[model samples]
Target: MTFTPTLSLYVARGFLLTTLLMLCALTGLVALFDFIELLRRAASRPSVGFDIPATIAALRLPFVAMQILPFAILLGGITAFWRLTRSSELIVARAAGVSAWGFLTGPGLVALLLGAIAVTGVSPLSSAMLARAERMDQSFLRTGGGMSSLAGGRLWLRQADRELDENGVAIVAGRPTAARPADPRDGFARFELKDVTVWRLSAGDSPLARIEAPRAQLTPGTWVLEEAVSFGADRMPTRPQRIELPTELTPGRIEDSFASPETLGFWSLPGFIEVLEQAGFSAVRHRIQFHSLLATPILALAMALLAAGFSMRHNRRGGVAQMIAGGVAAGFALFVVDRISAEFGEAGSLPVILAAWVPTVAGLLLALSLLLHLEDG
Candidate 1:
């Protein structure tokens, strides 16, 4: 059967319109809930006024949009195909020797293109906004104001160096302030942490040496402290011009401590991963994130095809509810498997590439098999 370009464009136009409307509706609902949550958090902090929640919600909207894009595509595809089926337009085309696969090609490609645009274009803006929102939230509405210096962040990692002292405690504070750094450039994130405190403990975790430094930076395998003051158990407190402390923690690990992979844009992830692995930290999570983003376009296309397969049946042979339900169930199943695989990847039980790509491949194959039965059989 010859598939006409006119038909393809017509189908693509309808699908794109529906997808965009669905995106707007879903994005608005998400923003409303996020605003409420931010408002609740801002209640106790005087620095955050009523307007802060709105600002935070706006900043977070793109990330939320990215999260729900697949579902939006699914629903949009279903809506578009079902509308055509109900109006008998698709039936007419089918009667004229048009195949479901041919008719679906346009919408499938459109979905894939949208997915790519989301990952490449929208993601960088979303990442930047998300990072800003997180920082703003921490600054204004964070609980435990002064001692928050001691509180853990989302990227917190604890490394024990037995060689330094069995009972020694190191307190690292501050985030990396660097921006758009290349992988080989002093591992920019390592220089971002400031205000370091080290405590030397005796047999029972009693303090033996208390070192306070205004600025501390993590290097390859050591912490360089500037203008440090040391207070010993028996000796008088002494001022040191520079104190270099041996550390098992690497720059990669320190970089991982400040920001999550999602908070970094797609363009920065590869360089950041290199920096992470070079400094002796695990890059599994970053690699997983990168591969997952790389798979988004194909995943979106699969979702579109699956949605059409589920909802394109003739109304004369009803069961729309069941078909749509099955599609949603399949989507949720894919999500669960992806989460499980990611956990395994992060735990180093599974290879990063396998963990990231397995769910995507499985989803696509499953959708393709189901569509073959529905479309060809």
Candidate 2:
């Protein structure tokens, strides 16, 4: 009954195990459902083999697990605390003058630590896999990638072409500028750009030509630019009524290249945000995502507190179910609020900091209030 280090470690160990179990269960179930959904989508495309959907679903699991982590913490905390109470371990601890907060400190810290690890370690892998999954989904499952991004009323895309030199050395033009290495599997597709500017580069990154157009539309395999003008290093600018350029970009690929903030790793976000803003695109969503990730540890602590509030008590008839239901409802309420505030922040209706931290703050306050009421009253 003593609140010794061994006792606290035991409690924390139990909580971590349960949380890991819950995460695995939830992630596996979700992945199974996702695989089925992908299979259904693949049904229409006879050429898409079974492996395509399976691979995509597997690649998507990490992102899904990230999204489900908070829920796993809530459920796991509830189970762990409920077990302690049901087994009279917490009851004996209370009889020994150890308050609820004393034992909960271990699990709360564990949750907080796990959240930090997820944000810093797991996020990068999840983002990369999510990006790859999106590309696969676009290429294999869908006819088009998706709607192209018009961030801050501008879009930036880079295209590359390769040629063999006389000595058989390969030269690349318009090299990729993304943080990650370009995937060799991506194929060329038609693309359209607005307020488009094309830079033609040669070996050693030397500029060859520059083309600017107000509007460009995709044809079968080319971009047709209207009111086009060209500039070269040694020649004066020439305006053309219309110009055609070959491309290997599709709307979907363009959208994939300009990935959403969620698909960029946490460490990569700041740089990508800077790139977006420098390219005349809004970084509001990326800013919101970054701040939200920073808030995850606090959010995890709140969930643990809330779970302890509901589940750490003397067992009463029919009370366990009620506490479980209430904890679940409260957890989901926090999630809904977080999503809503995020949307508001992205829409500029709320400050990014406020939107990102409000849910965590509110959850912590509410959980603390509940714990105080149960403990002191």
Candidate 3:
């Protein structure tokens, strides 16, 4: 028998309320612990107010929500279904001709709708806030002030090489100053590099000149090299020229490099990947994240099936404890597989789409098998 619109609405609302409450409680607990840790770290630094800490905590809420949403759906669906079973509601519905799949449609639809919202709406906000929070935390708490002399990360800069007839050049520094410049072009920023590699590509084509420097310092739109050697198109180092590499490049331009995939939001991953490819950077991680974001609905549905398949058996069987244990184990195993697949995708050993969707597909198949065996065998 098909449920009426009113009854479906009621079931959906009930499931949504239970899920939201569970998610809120879990997210709040995690956020509180995270905030306390941030506070403790902040205490060791200068007197920065609660703004950064609060912002970091607030920004982290959506990520926490996203992370716990599947578990919440699993637990809440199981709890709701278990209660219905224990109270004989499911039995009554089944006796009235409602099939298991029919009864599950309401909650499954709710999970799908919520998953869409979480991916499209919540993800961008969470990503933006996370970026801001990291910048603030790094600027105020970790750096102890504003920008430092020595920073550890990849730095990229574009310069002009008049001697090589190269108008625009790219330089990669192994380690550079974390110092924030008042102006993007101000070259007074100082950095000590262990190994510096400069790529001088043609104005519109291949590499024309390459340089390696033991160390370098920025001096107002120019880089001064110490113990530097230059390589030409023939792959031979010319006589060491104490030359001034003239360019409009600045410390700010060098420090604006983007690498970490986490900084890009789900909504922006596609565009960002396009930009990355055009700029000659690998977009594997972004591809994985994008596919993973698109698979969220399937993941949520799998979670629901996993929970219901295990927990919705008749109480007369006395397997509720076993069902709960199995559900938890399945969820954790799926998580581990997902992480391993993600690693493989990042390492280019697996296709991004396959890596992202494999766990969801596996969970769905397993849950469906279990459900069919229990309900129809």
Candidate 1, residues 1-377, lDDT tens digits: the string is 56878898899999999989998999999899889988988887776789778888899999999988988898888889889988999989988988887788899889999999999999899988997887677668775432234356212333443545774544444443343444486544454344666665544566567777776766666778788888777768796778877666655445344567788888988987776654345677889999999999988998888888888888889897888888888888888999999999999899998899898898889878887897676
Give the alpha-carbon lDDT of every model.
0.77, 0.78, 0.74
> TM-score of every model?
0.77, 0.76, 0.76
When summed lDDT is taken over every stretch of 10 residues in candidate 3, the lowest stretch is: 250-259
- Tens digits of per-residue lDDT for model 3, 95-130: 777777777788889988888888998888877777
Error of 3 at 281 (Å): 2.1
Q: What order do you get sorting by lDDT, best first?
A: 2, 1, 3
Q: Candidate 3, overall lDDT?
A: 0.74
lDDT of 2 by residue, 1-377 (tens): 23567678888999999999999999999999999999999999999999999999999988898889889999999999899989999888887888777787799889999899989999999998998998799878877434432344444554443332111211111212222333356643434455667776654566677777776775554667789888878757896769776555444434533677778888988876665553335788889989988988899899888988888766665587888899999999999999999999989999999999999999999999999998886
Clashes of each: 0, 3, 1
Clashes in predicted model 3: 1
Native-to-model Cα distance after best TM-score fit, residue 29 in candidate 3, in Å: 1.4
